[model samples]
Target: MSNIGNYIKLLRESKNYSQRKLSLISKVSNATINRVESGISMPDPDTLKKLAPALGASYEKFMAIAGYLTGENSANNHNYTTGGNLLLKEEMEAIDLISHIKDKNLRTWITDPSSIDYIVFAKKLSDMGIDPDFVYNEFVSRIMKKNRE
Candidate 1:
């Protein structure tokens, strides 16, 4: 299955939202939603962003879905918990950090289960000056530490 389809499925299931319900919430046509979910059509960035919030997800999530659709699994999985509050600053910082990492391998590792401490990961990226290789190594190191703990 294409990444877009996988993501659409994941987000839809996670939120317990039907495609028609998501269509209504996103103001997108149900056919469009179905097309995206089925990998028949890829939505533009703007349309994807609009649908994300309705799925109770963020733009990053939509980007991940896009990446998945493109057969690229370079999506960050930062399990950020703000307790129903959106931390705009932190989110922006994270977006900046992710943008800096141009390597797909590094990005995939950073977003994988092995490197889930998003706050620490972001801080490390900031401190290390956004070097993808360094960030990848640090992510591995952090994962090892967590496993040992």
Candidate 2:
């Protein structure tokens, strides 16, 4: 497995950034970057966010690499991969909410949910405070409509 520090170093080098330069750009402290690159420590979530764009990398992808989020092969199975039937952090939350659905038909239609991007789904559900049945019925309606066309 590749180390987070090594990846940081490589990314910094590719960007032609010295530790101080990277700190200046990323708003991360030089000491923190040094410790991270030297494999002595890792950055926190906030620090990783600043450093990622500065290094032209995705913050989410970086967090995943740092083990804050799930990796492709991780046992946590947090849907880091595309092909696997992994239930991600968000998916787990979605499952929790969906479990409250009293209607069996709606529940079964939404089964597996492996094809759903639970991250987005859960956020929308939470934000609107909408009932799961409404969401499920909407999805079912869409499918049925598409079938007719």
Candidate 3:
């Protein structure tokens, strides 16, 4: 089964919500819910957000599942640089971007000094149109420019 479908099913079951019940709570049509659950259609971001709360899943989890559903990782292996060898530029950028995430759990995961899942996390960021390297560079560039002023 597709990851989105699996996630929907898992959340639904976990929340004790049937397809119809979820549809009602999310204000999405039953057909839309069915389509998503059956892997027949990909829900748009707005619909996905509405459905997340209905299924008792956080928006971050929904976004992750959506990334998987849209084939965001299909062509890429989970590659990430790790260890204390990370450049100062990358570290500062990570800190800046992590600060912008309003979701506490996701922010914590992104900023934690240890136990970072760069592969999955980076994939998620890329799916959202954020290039990790680019973000790091931008953050560092801004800081450097500031210091030179």
Q: What lDDT score goes with residue 131 in model 2?
A: 72
Tens-digit lDDT string for candidate 2 (30-139): 99999987768877889888998898755665676677775454455443343543435554444445545566555545433332454456566867887766777899
Better-scoring candidate (lDDT), 1 or 2: 2
Consecutive 10-residue window with the lowest summed lDDT within model 2: 78-87
Better of 2 and 3 by TM-score: 2
Clashing pairs in 2: none
Query: Which model scores highest in lDDT?
Result: 2
Best prediction by TM-score? 2
Q: For model 3, what is the error of residue 111's alpha carbon versus the real structure, in angstroms, after optimal superposition?
A: 25
Q: Tens digits of per-residue lDDT for model 1 on 24-118? A: 88898899888877778887888877887786656755665464323333322332233333233344344445544656566555444225355
Predictions in order: lDDT: 0.60, 0.66, 0.60
State every prediction's TM-score relative to the real structure. 0.45, 0.47, 0.45
Q: 47, model 2: CA deviation in Å?
A: 0.8
- Per-model tally of clashing residue pairs: 3, 0, 0
Q: Per-residue CA lDDT of candidate 3, range 1-149, in tens?
A: 44566556655654667888888899999898888877788877788789877865455445544663234342243322344231233433443344444665555454333434454456668989989878768889999999999
